[model samples]
Target chain A: MNPTPDGFSTRHRGGKKSAARKVRRSSAVNRPSTVKRGKVVSVADGNAAIISKSFQLRSMQRAWNRFHAGSLSHWTTTIIIALSLTIFGAFTLLLSNANTALDNWTGDNLVTVFLEERTSIEQIESIQTEISKKSGVDQISVVSPAQAMARMKNMLGSEAGLLDSLDDNPLPFSIEFRLTDKKYKKTANLVYEIGTWQGVEAVSYDQIWAEKLAAVIHTFRFVGIALTVLLLTAVALIISNTIKLTIIARRDEVEVMRFMGATDSFIKTPFVYEGVLQGLFGAIGALLLTSLLYWGGQGAAAELGAAFGIFFELHYLQVGQLLIIMALGIFLGLIGALISLSRFLEI
Target chain B: MSSESLPLLIAKGLKKAFSVGKNSSLEVLKGIDLSIDKGEMVALLGDSGSGKSTLIQILGTLDRPSSGVVTLNGINLFALNPKEQAVVRNQKIGFIYQFHRLLPEFSARENVMMPLLIGRCSPKLAKERAGEILEKVGLAGRLDHRPGQLSGGEQQRVAIARSIVTEPVLLLADEPTGNLDSRTAGSVFELLQKLNQDLGLSCLMVTHNNELAQNLDRQLHMIDGCLAEEERGK
Candidate 1:
């Protein structure tokens, strides 16, 4: 039955189709792998002819083959996802810490009490003593009008005469009270208490600064949450689509695996592993960048502090937060890969 | 032997169709009724687009029949769910195509062990079985080579090793040697003949080669999606 053809061709048999063909049998060997059933122990010759009706054997083998074959892209994707998530974690931790420091350090809670013009030194001293005992007051500093002017002159040397030439001491005698916590409600309560004191002409706290602080805190929390969610959704999508593209590129390989009797789970394992690997790698990239930024910021802060007595600290990525970020990145990659694979496995 | 007495694979009035172009349905196969008995090598010969591939797909349970029933051994194919159908396909049937569909990323031995692994056989046993089969196919030394590294004929042999490693009841081939050179193609056919003789494996092949088709135990020619002639051959 072997044909000795030199090249590819289709020879037409003189009509629409050939008719009355004869059948011949040849004892040929070396058949295609698809047809060759290897020699094995059998109870009867007919038992070999009767194809055993079991599908699990081949599918299991295909799964193992895929894993060992390095056909799995899931591992790679997982690493990338893990890395991206770590960045998010670092950002969230640093942001929260920064907010806490700002709320604690702001001057919004400082209260100043102006003394009455007719008030004597003895009366002012008693008022200062009473204000210091207030529950919210952290500390109180008393500045007399004359002392205030002297201090202003000592600092402005050249402008000292201009300040002294004033017809009267323009600076008022005042007692400044600081609050423990910068909560606006607490600050207002303290202000109300101080304003009711005798010999006090006026009581005011930095209301504008208080309002600004409130706005900053609110906006920060809101923007942080929104950005994190948006970035995560984007990351998830990118990983999912990337895995899907990989699947499409390797569809033929998948088909081959299926024909080998691979189950859906078997076919999906390698892809999931690859996704996780990708996520982890991405997370590591983000961490490296975050680490560099932290180091650079700390260096800059040190230079600034040396040049001028101003201190600044950029929040760094905490270990716990870093771990969570890594985990999240890996999770995102796996989920994304699974989503893409779900659609293809149905076939 | 009477048709009912010979046990292998039987499809009664099997029909398959596919929808194309959104609304139009093209019936690829008009009802086909045939039986492949034990130890018989049946050849399905037809030109391209004559539903030859479609018939093999349905019979192998890779695709569903639009109508009628297919029974492999004693189990009804259409009655089983997809998971169970997959189980049936894995356990009972083997397949060979013109193109060696051995996974390129996996070694030849690993490819052969796939079916056994899927069936939950122990790794040790699967490995031993795979080793034995690969040796039989004369690929003992090339077991570690992936499909990409092997010649076309050798790759096809690996594919063959994978298909029958689990000892299925029926093997389906769709022009198994159509992609090989004449010499290699002949050798591949010879291996199929050997497996049939040595193991009594029942085989049904779809081919355009009349010479290869005629060598089977029985020849069924398809014209316009129906069996035109059935001849008993040497």
Candidate 2:
């Protein structure tokens, strides 16, 4: 029998326990056991449930300390996302501005003249020469009825060839004219005056088509604005979801932070900062990609345009628009982080 | 023994059960009664499935008991909401697990300062306290080393420093030495003993090794969710 303080049975597998074992068992007497107090019957019944301000400060510090180590992966994801957005942005710009340029191309004043059926070839040539001499006429080209018919047959295929076999030569001789419209809408008046000529049969113009095209362009501009809004929303959602997944992976860390006395705000602060950082990097990456594509496209268009002594160029996003893009990227990133935390920071 | 006037932790009739498999329930702790005084240390001994960890978790307020009352510094933990419970745990208690559980990405000093910062201390104060604790735990030279860079013993030391930096009322350890070699284990235990004595901090440690259990101030052997025997320090 052995007598120790608060003794029970001294017998065991051996005569004596080791000094380390004695030291290990001695700690049991150091504190009052919750078991003896009869208060902690389960996990829920403890008194240590308050968080102090110091805990929150600690959490913020830990988050900042870990910031650099975790930043690389976050930055990489943001850059990839930004690159994709830039490509889509460039595509949208090309689609919208290309149509704008084409509208301007068609709006330049041009007219077509129809000659009487019996009008001789000399009359058409003289009419072209007379039109070219006019101050309003920039250039004119006379087409003989037979040559016009042959060109139509070549362009329109078998149906047009069949028209050439008709009993009467129904095709009209014509001259096409480019105009310098002082009042912009004066091309219509010029057409009316040309129609009243003795040898002229009729005048034709595409003013109605131009008006309709203008309406279509107006609708396209509205659609482009809507698409941009939708794309930005999508970008924000994607970034937010990604950040949410990251939060899930670090759940244990978050739990530890909470136990360390960190407030919810303290924990979330670094995450928001991280999201903005990622967004900024992503925006820069996207801008770089957009510029590369723009320069390459301009070079290719210029090369193609050189063949016909015509010049082609791409219009880029203006400085103001570029600023908006960066702002939008950062805003979307922040929104994404907010969305992620909404689901994760419940506790 | 815990003084009735300044009891550090009090647990009453704690019961925790879990539903596992289909229509089957297993109770981990059944009507456990415990108390810890300020500056006391107790070793909770148990077999493989004796619910020691569950008990420690509940006492630490990391988890809620299915049915029971726990009061730490006279505050009823079970009555509080999850948010409040988190606040309490953050401020009043510190926990160490079998594994060091140190964040691999952080340096030793940062790891130690986690609880202090989370408890909302000033960065300078947290840093200073973290430095003090690290030095106390024999980690003075490894403050800037990450967990991966430090040896296992050093990492555990860092964990010890982290647990004590907040000056928590209760420090819970779940097999703190389970992963270490015998020599390193002794040194770790020695550090814990020094902290308990020098700081007068309360501790509740769960361990399986009968050898480890016998060295604490008091030992309670838990079997089948009930405390079977208790022995006090000489």
- Candidate 2: which docking quality band? incorrect
| Candidate 1: stretches off by over 4 Å | A1-90, A106-108, A116-119, A122-141, A145-171, A180-182, A186-211, A300-315, A318-320, B1-6
* lDDT of candidate 2 over B1-234, digit per residue (tens): 334576778899999999999899899999999988888889998888988888988887777788989988877888766655655666568888889988776789878866654433434445556787798898899999999999989999998888877666788999999999989988998898888898788889897766766778888888999877888963
Recovered native contacts, candidate 1: 0.15
Off by over 4 Å in 2: A1-76, A102-252, A299-313, A318-324, A331-347, B1-6, B13-27, B78-87, B141-151, B224-234
The weakest ten consecutive residues by lDDT in model 2 chain B span B116-125
Prediction RMSDs, each to the true structure? 11.8, 13.8
Specify the poorest-scoring 10-residue window by lDDT in model 2 chain A: A3-12
